[model samples]
Target chain A: MQRALTLAALALAIAFPMAAVPLDLDFYIGFASRVMIYAIAATSLNLILGYGGMVSFGHAAFFGTGAYVVAIAMTHGIDSLWVSWPLAMLVSGIVALGIGAISLRTRGVYFIMITLAFAQMMFFVFIGLKAYGGEEGLNMPHRSVIGLGLNLKNDATFYYVVLTVLVATLYLLRRLIDARFGRVVEAIRENEARMETIGFSTYRYKLTCFVIAGMVCGLAGALIANQTRYVNPNLMHWIVSGDMMIMIILGGLGYRFGGVLGAIVMLVLDEAISPYTTYSKIVIGFVLLAVVLFAPRGLAGLFDRKRVRAGGGHG
Target chain B: MNSATRMTEPVLEVRALCKRFGGLVATDQVSLDVRPGEVHALIGPNGAGKTTLVHQLSGTLPPDSGSILFRGDDVTHLAANARVLRGLVRSYQITSIFRQHSVLDNVALAVQARSGSSFRFWRPVRDESALFDEARAVLARVGLADRADVLAANLAHGEQRQLEVGLAVATRPAMLLLDEPMAGMGPEESERLIPLIDGLRKDVSILLIEHDMDAVFRLADRISVLVSGRVIATGTPDDIRANADVKRAYLGDELEAASGGEA
Candidate 1:
């Protein structure tokens, strides 16, 4: 039953842009693309925080790093999507490697604090870069050229692109979590001492998961930069990391596509509620409270009953 | 048969190991050895530093001044996982199986660790039938084959203890550091564990730290009595039973009762 629901959801997602085009709601296409991008970021965060049990609070650093990679490359007249996207992922992955290496040495709240500190350090560095608009942020001239007559500037095309990437990321992560490496990470989360005694170098495995999540989030960042045509230090803020964390909690931690579901719910709620009042955040805060108070497992938990059973044994 | 004949190269050797936490001496100049294929039991009262000594041997705790040799190699500085890779594994006194995973998954992970690089990100773990086959064999060995599909958290206390040993044994360790494998088990459960543990010595040496003196005496080829962070006696089961110093320092009437029950 749940598998059929997931397939139906995927079908609806793929047909969303087409349905929007016929309805003449072109602006919603861009909005949906933004949702897809955030979904990718949130999903990546879930890999470490939910699965690996490494609650990183500096994920926005990787996201912002990816955005800045694109912005900086554009400033240098290198506007190819292929070059900039891979470069963004590579830079974010390297930063994650350095940060994870240091942060993973400490655990629990200490790990969270260290990752936050590293991200704030990156934020301050971007703020101090006088050449890149500093605090105000930089603007992109246009979206990257994909070649082969594909125009990313077209909203419909861009939505499809974002959807493709989101679908691919979800599919890959699904396969990854069931793989041997994924099992090891989950085992480490369940019992680090037991994992070590069973011959797993958990530190190495955790660092690897951290790096992969960072790189995937970086891809989201690059897409966001293209969507907004802007890069700023605000993207690397600690609150942005908290927001992604909230999305995971709001959707359901450790659920395969919970991140996507969470991003959609959060973004749609923001879009709907923000027009009526300036206190959208306050309203959202209450919703989060309700979710936590009643459905402790998040929105995805309502759909999949097995999660409640699995979640019961968590230490 | 004789002391000299049994004195071949020991599989594990701890030389004058000492550890101090503030003013408390947890392990005080403890020295011991486990010969190949023998169940060398370390028996002690509560807070006797048996767990501390086991931690040091398993590479979890670093001793202040001592060395641990495994198969004649100095492994005092090796990390816990590295020591495990070298075929030295330990089980927890508290049951520590992966609670969320099925019994098969818990054992399969151990087999996966010994198989190859777990860095393979794409292939599904279920596709590897060899690991499941070996994991099933390990579960069967521990008499948990029937419960292989059950979540580890749902198992009874005795079953969980058995699964814990299954996890440790799946790694194919040359020496097993079992920390109270019979802890919290009823008499019947302990009875079941006795033969399971006794059968393990044919494949690997066991360094057992147990409070259950009956199980220790039944399984131990050599017994070491620890009192207040020190080894008070080391001998055969009969020698330990006859040793006055052991009785005076720690064993007391329990040894007499156990020996009488055995006779």
Candidate 2:
């Protein structure tokens, strides 16, 4: 049943852009692409926060860094997708290495606070970059050129790109969580002392996982920059980090693909409620409260009742 | 024991280890040794600093002033995991298996750690049949083979203790630091653990801190009685039983009860 649901979801994702045109709901193509991009970001956060048990509250630093890489490259007349995308991922991974090395030394609330502080520092740095439109943000005149007659400016084509990346990210994370490295991280999450006694340097594993997650989120940030054609300091805001965290919790903290489900639900709700009232956040907040109180395992838990009952529900 | 054999180098040596928390000295100049292939039990009264001493030996607690030598190497300053990698592994008094994972997975992780390639990121861990086989052998050794699929949290208290031993054994340690291996066991469970632990002496030396006097007396090749953060006696079981200082400090009543139970 679970496999069927996943397959159905995948089919829907692939078919949505094509279906949107004839259905006269073409705007949904770009909207769904945005959801997929956020899903990529949320999924990356889940790698560290859910699987590794590193509650990094400064993920936006990587996201904004990736976006800025694209924006800055565009400002310099470098429109190649291949160059900017890899550079974005590499730069964000390096940033994550520096931040994670220091932040992983502290644990629990201190770790959370430290990551947030680092992200805020990045936000301020970006805001102070006067050449890149400063606080107002930078605008890209055109989407990144792949140089193979492939146009990312087209909504349906771009939607396919985002969808492909999301699928690949999910696939990579699945392989990762089932790997030896994944087992060690999960073991560390369960019992760090025991993991150490059994011969694992948990700090090293966590730092590496942090860097991997940051690079993945950085890729998402690059995609978002192209989709929106804008990069801003607000992309690295603490509230954005909080939103990604909320998506993880709402989708299912440890469950693979929960982030995608969460991003879709959250983005859809945001779009739906915005037309009704400017206080859409109020509605979204109440819905989140309901989900937290009733489905502590997140929306994915609603599908796997047996797992929750068996006490093996963690993703 | 032959004099030459008795003088053989110790596998673990703790010399004048001391730890103080503010004004209180938790481990006050404690010294002990475990010769190769011998179960050297560290017995003490409550607050006798046995756990503190264990903490120092296991590298969890830094000593104010002391040194620990393992297999003729000074390892006092090494971190816990580094010590573990050097073939010194310890189990907790409270069972510390990976609670959310299956019993097999708990042991498998230990085996994986020792397998020298846990850094492999792309390969699925489940496909590693060698790790599973090794883990199964360890579980069978500890008599937990049947419970391998059960979650650690779902295991009986006795089974968790067995799993704890299995986890340590999976690491293939040269020396085992067992902290209360039978802390909450019934006579039946304790009976099962005795032979299981005694069986390990041919391969690994053990520095055991157990409150169960009967098991300690039965299993220990040499027993050290610790009272108020000091070793009052270190000798054979019969010698420790006859020591006046040991009787006065602690184990006075328990020794009598243990001897009576034995008879």
Can you write out model 1's per-residue Cα lDDT over A106-170, one digit (the tens) per residue?
A: 98899999999999999999999999999999999999888989999998888888888998998
lDDT of 1 by residue, B1-263 (tens): 56664448898999999999999999988999999999999998889998988899999998899899998889999999999999999999988889989999999999999899999989999999999999999999999999999989989999999999999999999999999999999889999999999999998999998978989888999999998899989999999988999888778877676678768
lDDT of 2 by residue, A1-315 (tens): 988988898998888888899999999888888999999999999999987888989999999999999999999989899899999999999999999999999989999999999999999998898999899999999999887787998999999889889989999998888999999988888788899998888888999999999999999999999999998999999999999998988898878977987898888999998988999878878888999899888898888765543333222
Q: For model 2 chain B, where is the 10-residue window of minimal lDDT?
A: B1-10
Off by over 4 Å in 1: A307-315, B1-7, B256-263
Specify the highest-DockQ model's number: 1
- lDDT of model 2 at residue B254? 75
Tens digit of per-residue lDDT, candidate 2, span B81-154: 88989999999897887889899999999999879777788899888999999999999999998998888888
Give me candidate 1's TM-score against the actual structure.
0.97
Which portions of model 2 show Cα errors greater than 4 Å? A309-315, B1-7, B256-263
Cα displacement (Å) at residue B250, model 1: 1.3
Give the TM-score of chain B in candidate 1: 0.94
User: Which lDDT values do the candidates have, in the order given?
Assistant: 0.92, 0.90
